[model samples]
Target chain A: MPRYRAIIAYDGTDFYGWQVQPGKRTVQGELEKAVNQMAKNPEIPIRVQGSGRTDAGVHALGQVVHFDLPYQIPANGVRKGLATMLPFDIGIEQVDIVADDFHAQYSAHTKTYRYQLSNREFRAPFRRNYTGYWPRRLDYDKMAQAIPDYLGEHDWISFAASGFQAKTTVRTVTDVKISQEPATQEITFEFTGTGFLYNQIRIMVGVLLEIGMGTRPVDDIPRLLAAKDRQQARLTAPASGLYLKSVDY
Target chain B: MPRYRAIIAYDGTDFYGWQVQPGKRTVQGELEKAVNQMAKNPEIPIRVQGSGRTDAGVHALGQVVHFDLPYQIPANGVRKGLATMLPFDIGIEQVDIVADDFHAQYSAHTKTYRYQLSNREFRAPFRRNYTGYWPRRLDYDKMAQAIPDYLGEHDWISFAASGFQAKTTVRTVTDVKISQEPATQEITFEFTGTGFLYNQIRIMVGVLLEIGMGTRPVDDIPRLLAAKDRQQARLTAPASGLYLKSVDY
Candidate 1:
């Protein structure tokens, strides 16, 4: 058997998530089906391991995955086969043969996630699926002033959803970038960190949005971090606006 | 009765077109339903007139329309009422009470249309419904060189679809602009004109795409215009990429 590493991208509107479930349409399920068909192994399904699990309606630009095949195939052949077999919304960006030691989940060192919001008077019809709609006016400068609070290491238990199974709630966040397009009124928030707890990014964004909307003071972030209680940050942004931007190993 | 003029936007992927048919979903059909609901009229359906008809799957950014209501309603009231009644895919941008003589179709002085193409090695799944996919490298400069021929008045018979009911194929195109985004590989073609024959913009974009792909010479545009034969420019681009950008009164 040979192992292969691949980069994948998908529009997650129609998918349940990145995990394989018995009766749901998922990104992992579709990828595994394509891989098994290409290898002509209908008796068994090859398990594809993703770097992380994304919630339903969460998109991805550069998701990393690894799988073992029953036999060896050329790198380009594998790419073409998977591209042809998978659904139109899921795209196979790159494929390469990798060493047996390259585990997609364990070998990842850092990951980046982005959340987008449409800060317009009304939601634009074309962008309904790709961005979360925030009809109220947002103060960009206020949002920018609060972004630095999310940097560095912190116990993100307040931002994490209940029932998350992480060993520790502390994670090192390396960077946070906030940008807004004046013409389109689209605000994007990007976070890069060593690891993230379940629903942490969406919760953090919800806090930031409240700050932008003037409902919460700019200095409220530190208080939320100190509380270390899930109730402190209860608003979780919609999954449609969240994207797994990249994974670095 | 009071006349109202409104600017509208929509995602046309699920619509049959702008015109109303018995069983098909259409933009006009939805707008009329919303207006009549507001008017509380069950006896007869109010007629909504669009600046022009758009083909199926063709989107709009600033499509103009007008209608006469049986009773008076504030502009803001009408806007909010329609917004609440209409589906999420269609948006009412602006509304104003206009004079009784105002007509959406006859009062228009100029209309601008845009056609977009994604020129990349592979089709981006997320942008499938918004742009036409051309999985080939294109020379933007070649396309730009041929855009000047489309400016000024010309008989666009070669670009018009068969069975068009326009009295004459002659139309004055006031301006043409071509631009490309290097990062996203999105090419946009914009044409501002006094009027357009049926399917003219899509046909012209198809010719421009062929020129950009090196299949047809840049100078081939003049020959096609002179030929005045519909077969000379038979490739009508997909309606997904066409947008009625604006209408000026």
Candidate 2:
């Protein structure tokens, strides 16, 4: 048996999430179906392990996953098979052969996620689908300055969702970047870290949004992280604007 | 009554086009309802007219519209009022006082619609929502060559959707500019015309697509326009990739 790794991209609108459930379309189920139907051994069950799970309406640009096959299907053939079998919105970005023991989640290095915000009084119609549209005035420079505070190892329990009960909330975020594209109303937040707690990106965006609006001081980010209480952080940003941009392993 | 022209933008995904209809959420109806509700005179009615109708899933960056008001409301008030009163997807970009007889549709000089096509085998999840996910091979250089055939006064009945009963199918398309953005698979078709027939932009894109894929000769465009039959055209692209980019009055 051989193992193959794939980079996936999907418009998360029609999907329930990455994992499939009964009666709902999901990225994992689609890939499994496509692989099983096309592979030499149609009976071979595939366990497609993704880097992480994204909420509904969120998107992925470089989501990494891996699965084992009973026969050798060329990397390009695997890509073409999944692409032809999947819907127009979901696609296999790249396919490569990998070690049998290679696990997408465990063999990992760092992951990066991006959240896009439209800082304009009126949102651009074409951009509204992917960006979080907020009419409030936002100070982009201040937000960019405040983004660095989230770097280093910190107990981000405050930013975690109330429903999320992780054993360890401490994660080392190597870099956090928030930038505004000049002459345009688009602002993007990029986070690179070994791991992230549940709802971490949403909460980080929410806190930065508060800072951008001048409702919170830049220095307050450290205090918020120290609080370690979910209620201490700002409200979570909408899922529609977040994306699992890349998984660098 | 003082008439004010309002520049509006909206994400048309959840909208049932721009026209008002029963059991459908339309941009026109939402704006009209919001304005009519805010009117000082409850008995009097108000209707908002847009520069043109944008079909469902189509976007607009510079769409102009206006409606007469029973009493004078500050431009800022109109912006804040409709934004707060109406749905979050639609927004009033700008507002100003226009001439007494200013009609958004009839007063328009040049209406430019951009037809976006993505020439990539793998559809980008991020861009799939905005661009038409065209997986076929396209000779962009050939597509550009076909533009000159549409740059003149010609009957565009063949470009229109069937059952569009118009008084005159003849429309003077002053210019048709097709440009490809380098380093990406983005192809933009800018149609600057006095007016467009129903589904004209999509049809024009379809003709270019045929030429791009080598299905039809680039020289056949002029002959197709002269034929005045919808069957002569290859196919009409989807409405999601079309945009009313600007309306210069």
Candidate 3:
């Protein structure tokens, strides 16, 4: 069996998430179906593991997945075959042959996640479908100032989504960035880290937004981190704004 | 009543066409509903007349439409208000008050229509939803060489869609140009004319494509036009590639 690594992108609107679930549309399910059809034996099972298990309606630009093929096929041939078989929205952006032991999810070194905020009264017709439409003014300078506070390793129990279970909450965030797009009303919160807990980016976005909306002060982020309780965290932002941008290995 | 002209852009995947139809999701119908909601009068009876009637799944960037408003509203206000009430894929690109005698469809001096062609074997995941995908290789030089033959006054009867009935087949094409996007697998054909018959641009694209694909000669365009029969034309290109880019009034 030859192992292949594929970079994928999806709209995430129709899909439940990246994981495979019975009777649900998912990125994992779509890719696996295509892989199985191409395999020499129809009965042979092929499982794909994604770098990030994104939540429902969360999109990705650089989602990495690994699957083993029963027969060796050129990477470009596999790409074309998958493109022909996959649905219009879910597509394999790039395919490459990898070492047999290479695992897309496990071998990932760092992942960059982005949460977008459209701080405008009216949403751009083209961008509204994918971004969160926030009809409020934001103090971007204050948001940028708060970035360094969340940069180092910390226990993010306060930012975890409801019912989120993890072995440990201590995670190293290498960088935290808040920036605005040129000539647009979009504000993006980018985080590069070793890994992330469930819904942590969205929760942090909500807290930053609360600060933007004058409901919380810039100093409150540190206090909230110290609280180590989900109750102290602001509301979770919508999944539409979050994107797994890239995985570095 | 004050008549206003609006420039529009849309992704036609979800729309039936530009005309108002019963039991179909049409562009005119959506605009009419939004107008009625804003005008707030049951008997106002606003009909948005389009510069050209596009077929189902055809996109538009500068489609012009006119409607009579019983009461005066700021142009900017109407633009913003209608945009807020409408869906994301449809938008008012421009809105302004024109002369009382102005008609969107009839008062135009010239119109420009653009058709997109995907020039690669592998399809893009995000673009497949909006653009027509083809697997065949295209010769841009041959297509570009053939564009000028369709430039001047002539009866473009053969280039119209089957069963299309317009009062006159004689039309003056101002210019026809083909260009490629830098570093992308997208080709664009822009056609400018004083007026175009129904489905004229689409059929021209088809003939151009057939020539590029080695199915027809570059000189076949004039030969088909001389035949003056709709059956002599090549296939009517898919609607996904056609766009009503602009209208000059």
Query: Clashes in model 3: which pairs?
Result: none
User: What is the lDDT for B177 in model 3?
Assistant: 81
Q: Which ten residues in a row have the lowest lDDT in candidate 3 chain A?
A: A120-129
Chain B, candidate 1: TM? 0.97
After superposing candidate 2 on the true structure, give the runs of residues whose Cα lies further than 4 Å from its correct spot: A39-45, A226-231
Cα lDDT of model 1 by residue, A114-173, tens digit: 998988876788888798888887888999999999999999999999888877889999
What's the ranking of the predictions by TM-score, best on top? 1, 2, 3
Model 1 local distance difference test score? 0.91
Candidate 2 lDDT over residue span A1-249, tens digit each: 899999998878678888878888888888777877777446547777898888878888889999888789899988888887877777788999998888899998999999988787765655655788777998877887889888999888888887887778788999888777867678889999989988889989998889888889978898998777788885788887888999988
Instruction: Report the lDDT tens digits of candidate 3 across residue range A1-249.
Output: 899999988888778999999999998998888888777446758888889698889988889999988889999999888887888777677999999989898899999998887777665555655788887888888888877788888889999988989899988899888889857789999999988899899888888888887789888888988899888885888898888989998
Query: Where is model 3 chain B poorest over a 10-residue stretch in terms of lDDT?
Result: B123-132
Model 3 bad stretches (over 4 Å): A115-121, A135-149, A176-189, A207-223, A232-237
Decoy 1 TM-score against native: 0.92
TM, every model: 0.92, 0.91, 0.90
The reply for model 1, stretches above 4 Å from the true place, is: A41-43, B163-166
Which candidate leads the pack in lDDT?
A: 1
Considering lDDT, which of the candidate structures 1 and 3 is the better prediction for this target?
A: 1
DockQ (model 1, Cα): 0.62
CA RMSD of all predictions? 2.3, 2.5, 2.8
